[model samples]
Target chain A: MKVPALVVQNLTKTYDNGFQALKGISLSVEQGDFFALLGPNGAGKSTTLGILSGLVQKTSGSAEVMGADVNADAFNARRYLGVVPQEFNFNQFEKVIDIVITQAGYFGMTQAEAAPRAEELLRALDLWEKRDQQSRLLSGGMKRRLMIARALIHGPKVLILDEPTAGVDIELRRSMWAFMKDLNAAGTTIILTTHYLEEAEQLCRNVAIINHGEIVQNTSVRGLLSQLNTETFILDLNESLDAAPLLNGYAVRLAGLDALEVDVTKGQSINDVFTQLTASNVQVRSMRTKSNRLEELFVSLVRGSAK
Target chain B: MSPARIQWVAFSTIVTKEIRRFMRIWQQTLLPPAITMTLYFVIFGQLIGSRIGEMDGVGYMAFIVPGLIMMSVITNAYANVSSSFFSNKFQRSVEEMMVAPIRPITILAGFVAGGVARGVGVGIIVTLLSLYFTHLQIHSLLVVITVILLSAILFSLGGFINAVYATKFDDISIIPTFVITPLTYLGGVFYSIGLLPEFWQAVSRFNPILYMVNTFRYGILGISDVNVWFSLGMLVFFIVLLGAFSLWLLRQGKGLRH
Candidate 1:
């Protein structure tokens, strides 16, 4: 759709000493997509982001952002993208307003244009109150938010966040997610790389899981979670069942001192399990279902890809 | 509007910000060199000069003024860029510039230009300070201007390289201490090489900084211990080499991309 917001084709990066960081990664992000790139530590996620942003040099292959080749037309490619790096990169000695405005200046914005945009972004990010404060004086959450504001100052079509909520608290994290979702809805494409699976599951409609410099899975959120059909049900019984009985073909395990966990797969109804429990003369105190569609899919994908 | 205009805007922003950063910290950037040079004038020019007398048909005070001024220019220009670039690297704020739509050459030019501003600014301040101690004269105004500008450009390139290679706060101190310090001291800032034996004079010629100071000295007093053309040639040579080297480092993303 519209040439996709970004196109990364066979992107490869190998550091000196032959340490390959990205091994021919090929992916595309559609326009207005809330895309999440998920991976464990050292899973080539940063390498991929770095190359896409024109920070890290790619060893081979090509990438394009907004129809502009990242390596060949880096300046033009970058005009459509903004990046929030993982580390604190702003000058601590600079005032918050100056940091954002200077970032705008790098894009050739005059002071008249950059100043108002900087203030607007700062206000939107809730940094207006501390606009004049030195960057060193900002708290961790404030600093992270400042980075978001800075990235948006240029009014880019695509925004990349590299671990935007790595050390932030739950409230700020949720609010930041809301802000990102609103931005995406308003037509700014978001490409996020995060260690937080829950955030990915909640906010991202599309997900890409990278492991060991390769994409293990790239699918729609619903499509990925639908792969997990089984639900883990816990039953607390009033009386202890005798003989440590083995159920007929049902996968079961002891969850706690008085609870039994039954993993029910597709084609097996919950009613059948209840009927079978009644026949065994086991008195059920309470029953609860643990819906782990995302977790289950995540674990299986990571484990299977590791092999 | 045009690409040239955009590039100039970016370059101006970088240079302006650098000037502002240093000017804001005037106590550290401007005051220290002035005080140091004042001490050198008092101790070396007056205290020692009265005892040693003049060596090259000029007052020892005026003799050392151009050298001191050049020393300040070289060091400040070098310091301004090296510290600024390294600080950006250490803080990771360089990412802001890196992620933007600016060209690599634009970034290099912005930084080198910033260094040049600070270097020339501090040189002017030190030159004025030298006036109070000695009567300054200009033998060749063109040489004086050319040497100052060329010297600043060369050192700015060296500073950018240093910043590219520096990883930590402590890492930045290595080159300035072990390399820059020795070069400046041995560059004939304090004494002319004519006073030294023939072997020492040959060794002094190997220093790139000697050419810069002697070139400026020749500009100021119409006297020199070395060939002016030779000094000019070396200055141009290092400028090209260091300029190419700095640009290559930027292209390679050396120590900057990690």
Candidate 2:
């Protein structure tokens, strides 16, 4: 039988001041899977990743990385895991390459053994030119890539990235997405927590959504997204419209003077809406989903769990 | 790699990083102490020692030499670990070790060894500098080496504990300034405690630094106000005490793990 990449069971955390961060939540990630763990702010996402990284001690529970229990055999457990935290956590005074190599050393690699791996990861992340430069001088996006290189230097089988692309520019975000896809395709099991729902939708095959310290939904992205029966899109009108017209009896509303909001359900042809809009003399200059499909389902699930 | 080798490599990495940190900023870490001790030698050993004549049976300059070197070892050892550990905490870069599989003992030993490096490095520099001032003879190199290394280890542990509990910059310097400095001055570094009144001499005996300073003086001058054997035992006691307390602090994760 193939062992799971990660297994967290009945994890709970309560801060000293009485705030419970994780309420006995449990989840698993399969080997070689690109898994997304999504939640809003204060939704226990970072707390979960913290526990897995052994940064925050759990109140009560167990976490295993590649069949090694974290508490019982930390060396064995951490050997298979690589973690990129949300915030930049390297010594600012250290050079870019030094940070990556130092991390390799922390995993027991010699300077000679780590040097080539550092070069390969640095070049892959487009940071080889800045290898000798101090990390404090790197741009925010470059710093993010530097951290990714540091995490991957040890070549762990499981990689957990917490908001790795936050504050990164669009182009870099796309490139990072490509890098992550390549990492995943190369059989690295990745568990990612990101605010950009579209990024999750694009890169992840499996997802778990948490709300109020509980796992509200967990399944394959396709299965969970398939539950999204309706999608809402905002259309840009060529001309100002004070009121939204009935478009093939689809739910419609006026979002702004030059915008119309419409809801489309599954199995409905978008062409029908275009035809109805043309007949009503409302021409849309552009169209986009108000929220991505996964986002819509996430909000509804979180809201439902709240109620 | 075998587990033991991996652990050894991990330990060496931490020590190497710490050494690089202090060495990279030589202006702040190394240069100041050498300069400060030179000033001490000039002002106290040359300018004033000529007037005061002899202390115990040795010339005043030679009398204060061992104390000054020991003083440098203690201060540099304490400052090195305290500042480095606290800075790592402040920057949150200490998380690098927290996330690694290294044992807490390995981390503590690495930091202490780094402190010893600076402490011993400064001791050697200060000792060489002392030779220009007065003629010197080694009484017992074994005692001198033992006292210096153990004193360095003890104070490094002290600094590590301070950094663990410190939340602000001021907290790191508070103990060194208010406590360590005053105790070191009263540790019979310059004047023999025999010059003190009976009651005052007894009080000075309680100062732990007195034991360390007196023992190092005994190593260099072969003269001590305190019992040399008792002083050696006291140094060992303090090291064991501080070492245990330091390991406990790491285990508790005070001001460290959340």
Candidate 3:
């Protein structure tokens, strides 16, 4: 049997001040898979990543990278793992290329070995022109890109990013998405944590939602969305409607002069709503879901699970 | 690669990065110590030695040169590790090493090596400057090399401890100001403990810097206030104790880990 890319079981962490950051969480990422670890603020996402990255010690249980135990055999474990932490952790005074090259050195690579790899990552990330500039001089987006270049220098089997695209512009975010997809396609397992649920919904096949220091939900993306009984879609009507158009067995409300909000249950066909609307003289200009499916499900799951 | 070879690479990488860090800021790390010791050579060695003439059967200028070089080495060694390690912690960049595959001893030794490099570098610069002011003689080259290396190693460990416990910039400077400086001054840098009265001299023997300065002084002039063998032994004992304590600190993740 092939080993998983990352295997974390019953991992727990309690800070010195007695805050239980992780309360025995367990999960795994398959090899060559793109996985999402999603959570609200302070929901053990970062803590889990921290433990896996070797920055924090677990109180009990185990975490492994490509079958190498993080505690008993950290050298090999870390050699197979790469991490991009949530914060900007590199020295700001260091040059951009030096940061990536230094990271490669940490993995026991010499300058000669690291330089060519560094150039590859820098060029792929579009940071080649900014190589010699001090990291402090780069803009926020470029700084984040520099970190990405650093993370990939060693080409580990598993790459974990803690909100890698936070605060990045849309164009950069899309480009990063493309880069990540390419990496995933090239046989590297990816584990990502992010606030943007659409990124998860669009990119990940498998996901785990953490809440209150525990894995509240773990399943495929399709499986999680299948649990929602209904989806709310907003219809953009070509003309103003004084009241909601009557559609039998559907909860429709007039949200504005030009829009109507309707709840479409799992069994109902969207074409039925369109057919009913045309008959009622409500010409539909356009339609889209009221919000991201994953976002809504995540909010409802977290709020419902809250004590 | 073999595991041993892997460790060597990681260790050398850390040392190289640390050396590059200090060299990149030579104005702060190298120049200041050289200039300060030169000032000491001129003011204390020339201006005052002219009036005082010889002490311990040698020119007062020659008497203080080794002490001044040792003093510069101690301060620079301590300052280099303390500032570099603390800055890494302040910026949280130390995570890079903490998360790496390297052993804790590699980190400890690498930082100490960097400290020693700066310390010895400053010492040599001071020694060369001393040649311009007066004639120099080497009484015992082996003792000079051994004691200088030991002294730098011991204080580099001291700086590592300070950086581990330091929570702020002021904390890094506090021990140096209150403990190290007082010890170095009373360690008989400018004047011999032989002149400190019989009772005070006994008290001076307890100061570690006293042993280092006197042993280093004996290396240069073949004259010292304490037994050179006993002083060298004390230096080794302190290095072992501190090196073990520093290794324990890295294991505990004090101030470095959450």
Candidate 4:
């Protein structure tokens, strides 16, 4: 059997103040897989990443990267993993290219070998033009991209991005998403922790949601979404309604004079609701889901775990 | 590349980055020491030494030259590493090194090397500045090289320790202000310890900086109030002890890791 790209077994972390941040958290990511780690604030996602990257020591348990134990074989383990932390950790006064090239050097790449790689990543991230500028001068989106470029400069087999697109504009976020997709397509295993559920649902094949230092839910995105028995969508009508509309065996609530929310169960289609609404002489103008399916599942699972 | 080669590359990269950091700010890192040392030469060596005439049978300016150079070396070396490492911590950029594949010793050595570079660089600059005020001769080139290099290494390690324990910018400055400056001034940088009373001379022996300054003085003037061999042994002892202590702090991940 092929070795997993990353693995955590019963990982636990308790800070100096006796506050436990991670509690027996276990997880694995296969090679070439795009995985999402979802959690609320302080849910151990960053802590787990920190442990894997050797920034935070684990209180107990073990983590392995590309079959190398993180604690015992740290050099080899780190050799296969690249991390883009949630914060901008590079020296702001350093030139952009120097930051990326220097990061490659930290992994043992000589300047002769790292320069081309740095250039390539910088160009791919659309940061080549600003290579000589100090990092402090870059825009927020550019800095985010620079961090990604720095992480990729070493060409590690696995990449872990902690909120890589946090605070990014929609356009820049989409561009980064495309770039990451291309990276995954090139066979780099990626583990991402993000608050954007839509991004996770769109990009990741598998996901694990943690809450209160425990894995509350772990499954393929498809599997998790499939567990949702019903979905609610909002519909806008062409004309204002006088009162609530009756539909056959369908629950509907009037949100406004011209809008209504309808709950549709599994195996039922919005077309069926349209058919019933047409029979009631209500013409629909627009329709949208009340929330992303993954978001709904995340909130419910986190709430359930809270109890 | 082999793991050893990779480790070397990482070490060299950190050293290079640190050197570049200070050099890039040459006005701040390199210029101030030269100007300050020149002022010391003008006031203490020229004006004060002219009045004193001679110290320990050597011309006063020449006697204080070695002490002045040693002072710059120690202060610059300590300042470089302490401020640089503390800045890395303040900016959270040390995480880059903490997460790298390099061993903790390599990281410590890299920062120390940067400190030594700045220390030696500033020492040489100060020595050249002293040339205008006094003619200098190297009494023993071997001693000159060893003492200067050892002083740089010792203080660089000292600076590394200070940086490790520092929690804020103010903490980094506190030691140099309260401890380093006083010890350096009292280290017999200006006056010979032989001029002190018996009890004060005994007390000065306990000050580690006195050994460093007196050893460098012997290197330059072939005159030392302290035994050269004892000073050498003390310098080596402090280097080993502090080196080990700094390495221990790195391994413990104190201040740099969570």
Q: In order, what lDDT does every prediction score?
A: 0.87, 0.90, 0.90, 0.92
* Residue-wise C-alpha lDDT for candidate 1, range A223-282, written one tens digit per residue: 887777788989998877544346676887876667788888877888888888788887
Residue range with the least summed lDDT across 10 consecutive positions in model 4 chain A: A241-250
Where does the lowest 10-residue lDDT sum fall in candidate 2 chain B? B1-10
> Candidate 4: where is the Cα deviation over 4 Å?
none
For every model in order, the TM-score on chain A comes to 0.87, 0.94, 0.98, 0.98
Worst 10 contiguous positions by lDDT, candidate 3 chain B? B1-10
Give per-residue CA lDDT, model 4, range A178-272, as digits (tens).
99999999999999999999999989999999998999888999999999988999999899987879888789999988999999999988899
Please write out the lDDT profile of model 3 over residues B168-250, one tens digit for every residue. 99999998899999998899998888788899999998898988888898988999988999988888999999999999999
DockQ of 1: 0.63
Winning model by lDDT: 4
lDDT of 3 by residue, A120-163 (tens): 99999999999999999999889888888888888888998999
**Which is the leading candidate under DockQ?**
4
Cα shift from native, residue A53, model 3 (Å): 1.3
Candidate with the larger lDDT of 1 and 2: 2
**DockQ values for all predictions?**
0.63, 0.73, 0.72, 0.82
Choose the strongest candidate by TM-score: 4
TM-score of each: 0.90, 0.96, 0.98, 0.99
